[model samples]
Target: MTAITRLTVLIPEVEPAHWWQCARQNRSGAVIDRALRRHTDAVVRRLRMRS
Candidate 1:
C-alpha cells in the first residue's frame, strides 16, 4: 500500500524533486510542460509508488 507520506493537501505532481517538477501542483488541470530531467523522472516514479 502506498502510504501518504506527504502532508500537503497537494496532488501527485507538485513540488517535484526539483524546480521543474510541475506547475499544475496547485491547480487541477494546468499541465505544466516543463520537461523534468531524467533523474527527476526516477524520483517522481518512486514517489508515485509510495503514494
Candidate 2:
C-alpha cells in the first residue's frame, strides 16, 4: 500500500486575480515557501527510500 499526503490551499475570500498577482510577485511568501518545502521534502524522502 502507498500513502499519499495532499495539501490544499484555500483562500475563498480573496479575489482570484489579486491572489495570483501576489503569488507571482512574492514567490517566497510563507505559505508558498512552506508548500514548496513540503513538496521537496516528500520528493527527497521518496528518492532516499528507493535507494
Candidate 3:
C-alpha cells in the first residue's frame, strides 16, 4: 500500500484547462495524482538521458 502525504499546492492564477475539466467532472484526486506521477516520470526520463 502506498502512503500518502498532505500537500498544499499554490497553483498559478491560470491553471491547466484539463485539470479544471477533470475537477468539474468530479474525477478528483486520483486523476490529478496520476498526472503528477506521469509528469514526474517524464522529467526523470529526460534527466537520465542527459546524464
Candidate 4:
C-alpha cells in the first residue's frame, strides 16, 4: 500500500499596470516606510543645507 500527498497554492487574479504599483501592492507597513523615507530625506536635506 502507498500514501499520496497533495499540495495547493493560491494566486492573485488582478493585473497591475506598472512595476511599482505591483511592488507596492505586495508590501506591508507603508506608513512606517513613508515615515522613514521622510526622516531620511529631511536629514539629507539638512546636511546639504537645502531649503
Candidate 5:
C-alpha cells in the first residue's frame, strides 16, 4: 500500500484555478500525484544515467 502524505504548497493564482477545473473533471489529487511521480521518476533516471 502506498502511504499517503500531506503537502502544503503556495502556488500562483492561475494554478489554483487550473486545479479547480481539473477537480471538476477528475480527482485533482490523482492528477497531481501522477505528475509528481512522473517528474520524480524522470529526475531519478537522469541521475542514475550520469553514474
Candidate 6:
C-alpha cells in the first residue's frame, strides 16, 4: 500500500458581472486576490523545496 498526499485550493466562483462590479467598487475583491496570491506562492515554494 502507498500513502497519498493531496492539496486542494478552493477558489470561490464569482460571476463575471458580479466580479466586475466588486472589483470596481469593493475591497472584497482585493482581499480575495491577496489570499489567492499567498496560496499560490506557498504551493510554489513547496514544489520547489521538493525538487
Q: Give the winner by lDDT.
A: 6
Local error of candidate 2 at residue 49 (angstroms): 39
TM-score per prediction, in order, is 0.18, 0.24, 0.27, 0.30, 0.29, 0.29
**Runs in model 4 with CA error above 4 Å?**
27-51
Write model 4 residue lDDT over 1-51, tens digit each, in one string.
Answer: 899554322222344566566664543334445565666543211111111
Off by over 4 Å in 1: 1-14, 27-51
lDDT of each: 0.34, 0.40, 0.39, 0.40, 0.39, 0.44
Q: Model 3: residues >4 Å from true position, as ranges?
A: 1-25, 41-51
Q: RMSD for each model, in Å, please?
A: 13.6, 13.0, 13.9, 18.8, 14.7, 11.3
lDDT of 3 at 2: 100
lDDT of 1 by residue, 1-51 (tens): 887553222225334565554553454322222223222332222123121
Candidate 2 lDDT by residue in tens digits, 1-51: 999886544322232354445554432334654565677643221111110
Q: Could you tell me which residue pairs clash in candidate 1? A: none
Candidate 5 achieves a global lDDT of 0.39
lDDT of 6 by residue, 5-24 (tens): 65554434343444445454
In model 6, what are the clashing residue pairs, if there are any? none
lDDT of 6: 0.44
lDDT of 5 by residue, 1-51 (tens): 999665443222222344346444434444555576666542211111110
